[model samples]
Target chain A: EAGVAQSPRYKIIEKRQSVAFWCNPISGHATLYWYQQILGQGPKLLIQFQNNGVVDDSQLPKDRFSAERLKGVDSTLKIQPAKLEDSAVYLCASGAGAHQETQYFGPGTRLLVL
Target chain B: SQQGEEDPQALSIQEGENATMNCSYKTSINNLQWYRQNSGRGLVHLILIRSNEREKHSGRLRVTLDTSKKSSSLLITASRAADTASYFCATGARGAGNMLTFGGGTRLMVKP
Candidate 1:
């Protein structure tokens, strides 16, 4: 059983630049999520999708952060005009259903904005 | 706003010792989960306890939930050096649809 996959494990970019992170969830998983984890803090959800449709994105920064889980298998989180505050690890996770069950996570992308 | 907060931001103990961490939440929850994250890695689910449940044990890990106080505890007995990592507690509420509110995390260091 393959776990969730994400890339570029590490990214370094300048402030105001655009950065994009990709995620490929586990096979047959139905739900996907994107979370931002600042240093020394827990992950904060940015967006959630259930099969190509957004389930929740209330915490997402609409001004510069956007995410899409097209085809219900892969997802991409984009942070445009990135600020230094955006320098955090972006994690992607997947679950079997829309319940509080086990969730598999990817390696995560560590973004460092200068 | 974060729903839970873990005590003892960091802890260190020799191998074969017990490691106990606490998590306190703010509101009612449908379930609570614990995850471990190694240095520079993603989180791995360790255990999950439902609202109706009080205690669950998985191998060397034991979890207890007290809804009355809205708090939970994770006990790792005879922990090994491999157990050195950051552990986080996450809470799930009704109608959340799988959303998890996590705590700041407790860093555990087990010396061999």
Candidate 2:
């Protein structure tokens, strides 16, 4: 079976610019998530969605970062006015359910802010 | 903040040797999982041990959880060069749905 898919494996933008990443989860998966991984650090959860509805986004930087899973199959994460600190790999993962399930990850988008 | 923290930020070993990595978490968890990430790639789940389980083995990998100390360990026996990667331990905390909090990761290098 195909795994999660993401677009634009790499991206570069100037500070204050806007960048967007897209993710297509595994077929039939019901939960999707976005995570940010800085160099030399583990990925940190940014937002989570369960079939077009957000389950958790408490760690999301609502002031500049936003994500949406409109159809529950694909999702997008956007960062407006990006900062140099935002340079990191953004990963998208999907799971079959919202409990005790394994998460499948995409190749991830590596973003660089100049 | 991350709930799990891995020890020995980096390790180096020759092929056919054994490699061990440890993870400690701060809160109650429903399960702990280990993932491997090759440089510049996404993470791949290795193993998951539930709270009620004490040990699990998958091929060359063995995982042990000690809830009393809130720590878990991953042992990879007869390691190969292909096993060189960053290992991360993630905690699925109670009431957190399916979300996982990952640790800083342990970088393991196995020489062929």
Candidate 3:
């Protein structure tokens, strides 16, 4: 089966500019997630969606970041007025509904804000 | 605030040896998962152990959980140079949404 897919494997932007990342989850997956991974650090959950509905986004930066999964199959994450600190890799993952279901991840989009 | 924290930021060992990594969390969880990442690629799920379970094995990988202490450990036996990568532990808490909170991860390097 095909795994999660993401676009623009690498991105370069200037501070204060806006950038967007896209994700296409595995077929029949019910849950999708977006995470940020800074250099030398683990992924940090930015938001989660269960069938186009947000499940959790408490850690997301409301002032600058937003995400949406309109059809429950594909999702997009946007970072506006990007800051230097926003330089990191954004990863997307999908999983079935089971609580212990294993998640499949995409190659991720590496963003470098200058 | 990060829910999990991995010990030993980095580890280096020779091929054929065993490599172990530990993780600790602050909250109660229903299950814990381990994932591996090579270079800049996305994470690959390795294994998962429920709270009621103490140990699980998959091929050369072994995971042990201690709910009482809110900790888990991953052991990779007979490691190979190809096993060099970063390993992260994620926790799924009950009623805390299905999202997972990951730890800083442990970078393991197996030299031939």
Candidate 4:
């Protein structure tokens, strides 16, 4: 089976600018996740989707960050007025279920904000 | 708050030797998983050990889980130069709303 797919392997933008990252999860997977991995740190969950409905997004910066999963197949995460601290790898993962399932990850989108 | 924290932020070893990385976590977990990342790229799943299972093996990788201690360890036997990468342990906790919390990771360098 094909793994999760992401676009724009890398991107660079200036601070206060806007950028968007896209994710296409594995087929038949019911759970999708977006994680931010900062340098020297592990990935942190930004949002989670279960069939186009958000399950968790408590960590998301609602003021500037917004995410949506349309049709529960393709998802997009956007950050308005990006910050230097936002420079990190955005990882997309999919799993068969929210629990007791292994997750498959994509190559990720490496974003750098100057 | 990160639920998992790995010890020995980094490790350097020679090929053909065994490499061990430890992870400690707070609260109960349904399982623990090990993942490897190369060059800051996406992580690749290595192994998973359930709360009830004390140990699990996949190829040259072995994972041991001690629920009593709230800790786990990953052992890579006969490590290779290609094995040089960052290894992380994530805990799946139902208490944390069924999310997997990852550790800071252990950077391993294997010299051939």
Q: What is every candidate's alpha-carbon RMSD to the true fold?
A: 1.1, 1.1, 1.1, 1.6
**Model 4, TM vs. native:** 0.96
lDDT of 4 by residue, B1-112 (tens): 6788998899999999999999999989888989999985798988888899999999999999999999999999999999999999998866423567899999999999
Candidate 2: regions farther than 4 A off: A97-100
C-alpha lDDT of all candidate models, in order: 0.92, 0.94, 0.92, 0.89
Alpha-carbon RMSD, candidate 2? 1.1
Clashing pairs in 1: none
lDDT of 2 by residue, A1-114 (tens): 899999999999999999999999999888899999999999999998988999999999999999999988999999998999999999999986547368889999999999
TM-score of 1: 0.97
Error of 1 at B112 (Å): 1.2
What's the TM-score of each model vs. the native? 0.97, 0.98, 0.97, 0.96
Interface RMSD (Å), every candidate:
1.5, 1.5, 1.9, 2.3
What is the per-residue lDDT of model 4 for residues A16-64, given as tens digits with 9 covering 90 to 100? 9999999998887878889999999999989988888998998999999
Docking class of 4: medium
lDDT of 3 by residue, A35-56 (tens): 9999999899999898889988
Winner of 2 and 3 under TM-score: 2
RMSD (CA, angstroms), candidate 4: 1.6
Chain B TM (all candidates): 0.98, 0.97, 0.96, 0.95
- Model 1 regions more than 4 Å off: A97-100
The ten-residue window of minimal lDDT in model 4 chain A covers A95-104
What is the DockQ of the complex in model 3? 0.66
- Model 2 chain A scores worst on lDDT over the 10 consecutive residues at A95-104
Any idea what lDDT model 2 has?
0.94
